[model samples]
Target: MKPKTPRISAVDLFCGVGGLTHGLVRSGVDVRAGIDLDPSCRYPYEANNSAVFVERDVNEVTPAEIKSYVGGRKGYSLLAGCAPCQPFSTYSQSGRSKKRGLDWQLVSKFGELVSQVQPDLVTMENVPQLQDHEVFEQFLGNLHGYSVSASVVECIKIGVPQSRKRLVVIASKLGALEIEAVGKKGNSVRTVRQEIADLPPIAAGEKHADDPLHAASSLSEVNMKRIRASKPGGTWRDWDPELLAACHRKTTGATYPSVYGRMEWDAPAPTITTQCFGYGNGRFGHPEQDRAISLREAAMLQTFPRDYKFLADDETVTFSRLGRLIGNAVPVRLGEVIGEILVEHVRKAEKGTLRPISEELSGRLF
Candidate 1:
């Protein structure tokens, strides 16, 4: 008989649009429930990930509930948590942050749950800046006996189409664990053309019936005029003298030229952010196309599948809502890489014999 398929189950905390959940499922892990307080996520989380969305706060969640949701058994029960990182994100320090609240305590809340549930595996992904946080240091210290591993790895090296770095950690009660990150090959990262080059042409705010999520958000009048003048890989500086934004003319705004720009057809995209649907956000404009990258393109740059559904049939395509979902997701591709490492960790867990790399993965390194 074919060797029994690996039995792994996962519970996703702060799961936005089920990107990671969907990836784990595709990799043969049985993803149970995607826990998040956002009720809006119910549609896409369940629609694409095939996992139930538990619309409850992660901090408020109890170990009994986690055990039940993960289906307590001999199989590996993976707890994946990506607490809201706006507080620790570089963007928070880059400018004045408009976001704050109890949600910032969630990373610690996750550590508390990990102490209680002691799942077979643990995974957390967030912006690379989080590695510098005192809370991150304390969280890693809390894993006393378990084999743990974490790194501030780049997403591009792992096949993500965008240039994004994330802090990924994996821990296990089993023995030691290790996950080797894919090294970046000569700067030729996957390009914008490789991602969505062949799709039929689409205008701003247009939707393609062939792909449910292949729709771009509409541009405002000013942005429309700007895009008309912009070239692929070109910046807002390319705009005609009359079309410059008042902010761009300001001395401070001149420092960031990547804003309000178009991606190059042969180049990788800038990081996809919550505002990626907006023409003025980052370099989200489609290469050769006169519009900001669509919700679908954003998701694709984040390494979600081409046909991944972002909404249920009854759900309306609201830019604010869908953009938030796609922007906030733990790129499924990242999760799959984590899953493969965790699966290997579990396989060696019984003997408590962690691969050397696993040991290196267990220690902390900035």
Candidate 2:
């Protein structure tokens, strides 16, 4: 009889709302657990993914604890971390020197754990700006024993219905590493209309009675008037001068035209930020509706499944809390691509026909 293929298992650090876990599972990796500092994540992370949620800060995680969670599994073990990227984000760059502190240190901690535990595989995703930081360089330097490949991926090219950019790194102690791209532009790019056009519409400041999470934040009277005048792909520049905010009236703010704009139905959405439910944040206004995208719509754009449960039936949907969880999640489709990359690498290694790192790293392997 032929021997069985050994299972690959993973532990997700800073796993917000189980986005990475969900995608990895869909790609056939057994995600054993998730670790995060937020107590709020426990419910959705565990409920949706069927994985244990350890409510602890990544800085406080010990290598021994990680080993125990893997339960002495004999196959490849994976460690994935999507460290908070706000410290390295473009919005924070202007004040980074003053704000640089513990969060920046977390990446170094991830490096330290990898050096100590030497998991079979390690993967991470963060803002593309992180590639330019010294900390990222140090993390790459620390992976001397592994084959590593890192790239700035356009999320839209990976089946996500948003034009978000992220830096994805895949490292393996086993063999050569490569992450294949997913959706291709012009041919397979998903659009806002494709993802959420079928959902029942709700008016500004209203919730869908059937799906509580499909609720939009209440808009102020002035903001309702502002959205009424807004056009898809159009900016506040098109609005009546009287409706423009005092900030937009200034030359400096005029340069920020994407704010308070509506997303085009056929195009991908702007990046979903932690405050996406507010009409004033980014191009969050609905293409046709007079309110910002609902919490469910924002999650779907992040590549979460349409029926993914985030809250209990009795719980009131809190826009601020859910927005942070959805905005901060690693897009599930991106995670699935990462999983497929690792799985293919493992299969090639087992066959004793692994490709050379230099050749594989030169071009798009996907």
lDDT of 1 by residue, 1-366 (tens): 643546888898898788888777766788888899988888778777667889998878999999997755757888887888877654445432555345447888888888888887788887777777788887787676667767887777767788888888877777655443233122246888898887778899898887757788888888888988888888888878899988899999988898888888887788888888888878888887888888888888888887777777776678888888888888887787777666655666555566543345435422
> Candidate 2, which segments miss by more than 4 Å at Cα?
1-6, 92-99, 178-187, 356-366
Name the top lDDT candidate: 2
Candidate 2: Cα lDDT at 116: 76
How high is the CA lDDT of each candidate model?
0.78, 0.85
Candidate 1, overall lDDT? 0.78
Best by TM-score: 2
The deviation in Å at residue 290 for candidate 1 is 1.1
**Pairs of residues at least 3 apart in sequence or in different chains that clash in candidate 2:** none
